[model samples]
Target: MHPVEDHGAPGSGGSRSAAGWLVLLALAGLAAFLLARPILTGPVAGLPAVAQSSSPYTVHRPAGGVRGGGIVNVDTELGYRGTLAAGTGIILDRDGLVLTNNHVIQGATALKATDTRTGRTFPAHVVGYDRSNDVAVIRLSGAKGAGLRPAAFGDSGKVSEGDAVTAKGNAGGKGGAPKIAQGRVTALEQTVIARDDSDGSSERLSGLIETDAAIRPGDSGGPLFNASGEVVGMDTAASAGFKMAKKGKGRGFAIPINRALGIAEQIRQGHGGAKIHIGRTAMLGVQVRPVDAGRTGSGGQSADGGQSGGQGGGQGGGAEVASTLPDTPADRLDVPTGAVITALDGEPVDSPNTLTDLLLRHHPGDRVALTYRMPGGQPVTQQITLASGPPQ
Candidate 1:
């Protein structure tokens, strides 16, 4: 045919097309190598590190980092900024009243809680607290319809150290998300000292489980689970260092769930379906830092300051008073929200810590006179009986 002798093969156009594809493939391969250089070299080349460069294993966590069960690596985040909304809680009764650590709500007074997996949020209220036990009960508004999911409680007495344990918490809120951790109980009946940063005092606690699983601040009040998914303890405090204890901030502690259930009973029966037992009233619910010469509230805690912190005259706390129960002693005496309580029962009230200490000496349904400033700008003296709700 036309150039049969000179043409190397038939369908020369096909050969040209194949050659073009080969060129394209080479170019693509080169581009891929160029773009992937970072991931390939930093770790593969054994160079130092840059952000986002790591080996096949292990990730990074900052001071705010959060994770779940077993160091097995689930979702991660920077830290807690009050973003978490819901976690596994105990359903103690048919009334749909749930029990959790008061701190889980962080004194929100009211909140929206949703199941981590279901994405359902419901309105919740602080029902009560038995302070000495640090257990709080919350009543879910319209719990039946709010997709309320209740967790079962495992007997702390039944749990032994070195047993497998699981911890679940809403660490990042939307970012940290929900995570689980797997660990063995390293220590049982461990004595831990906890400092309420709000008041700046330390608490010596016993009967706490020591685990190797990572725990964070927001994890407080969350449920510590067992292999069968039963709760053993309420995540309370991480083992931290004081001037006295040099241990780093890694050990996490939980109030025994069985203990929490006992205190929850009082709160479930008392004031308007909410029982508040004042066990310890010495701790204030605010954190303070030296501000502009005098002092100011550093963390979201009250700026008014309280006696629980490192050093204070007696007591001072700066949490916003949302409101008082109606017809109750506090309400009857006209103790209104927005009043910064500087003292209670003649004790200088600065933080919830001081109040907690005072309450410790009293019983539920006991009446105490409180002097407070009126929101309308008046310093008033009034005596109000303290009605009990739940254990703090």
Candidate 2:
């Protein structure tokens, strides 16, 4: 989730940090605040101010018009500092169903897309996501019968090494006409580990189509067109420092379109599995960190340096609360900072990741018991109603 540097133009080449090479094709200024610990060292006045927009739905279109069937410039408003991130997507249906990478819309508070074909912008909502596979499906708001043109699909199984391909996307996050890069497929069924520098989280992606195309940032979720002008894959990760057979070109990877479409179909049918989450995510509204083992519950002090009062010892393992969002279920219940969340319902919560996985199993309006322990206190359980949260 490293914020992409704003080049402000297409094909403006730039060198990336060491971490950048591990993950590419993410959005500019993209940050997942919920997945990482927030900075609490400074006062609000010390932070730089970002101007707020009067209208959240307004999209800033580039000067030149773009042409393509069902391709779109996806814009996401993050939860932090009014920052806007951009990526690409492909239309799956005439009613504005779009397929994109999960990382493109991850941590987005608001979403909108400009169709490259029609040059029309529309608000959008997530239908479902397979976070492990990095695939997501979203539908345009009020576009059930919009008659949008869908991208041409090809059989990925028929693809082979040395095939000529074209990658098109909003390169460098400059939202004008889609940038085009031509190259030959170098390999098939390749695997790579994509890491998010912002949070140090990583996921393994396999069965990828490797190419020498320059798939830059903002090119994510765009189409990898074969010689026949049919999409064989979705543009995904690109290596910045890695060497390729073609010395001047960068190495790019794409998820096979056949696999992506299969997952998209599962999402469209509202099928939720271990790796796929359907609809909106449920929120506990509390930012947490791993509990420090050195800091045992004593002297009425919580694990996160907050004050608390109780008569018992600390729990060995749990997620320590760093802060709670206002008007959230955790806030309404007075779940104090530094408190250790030991469990959700009856499942043990050892870390923030575990807590997230447990919460994903439920949806908004679901009532579940939350178990926690204050500093120097015994375990306490309370029933809290979950609320709707931003897409994960």
Would you list the C-alpha lDDT of every candidate in the order shown? 0.42, 0.67
- For candidate 2, the per-residue lDDT at 252 reads 81
Off by over 4 Å in 1: 1-88, 93-95, 145-147, 175-177, 196-199, 241-249, 271-392
**Clashes per candidate (backbone, < 3 Å):** 59, 0
Best by TM-score: 2
lDDT of 1 by residue, 1-392 (tens): 00001133333311111101110000111111111100111112322221112122121111211222211101111011111132334454434466665544432323545545455445666665654455666665665654434565556666665677777665433323456666666666555544433223344455556665655434556678778777667766554421133333245666665566656655555532222442322222222121112433332222333233322322234223444434445555555655545455676544444444454455554555555444444455565555543222
- The TM-score between candidate 1 and the true structure equals 0.52
Q: Residue 147's C-alpha lDDT in candidate 1?
A: 41
Q: What shift in Å separates residue 70 of candidate 1 from its native position after superposition?
A: 20
What tens digits encode model 2's per-residue C-alpha lDDT throughout 159-269? 887888998887666676778888888877776666545544455676778788877667888889888878888887777443233554567888887778888888887
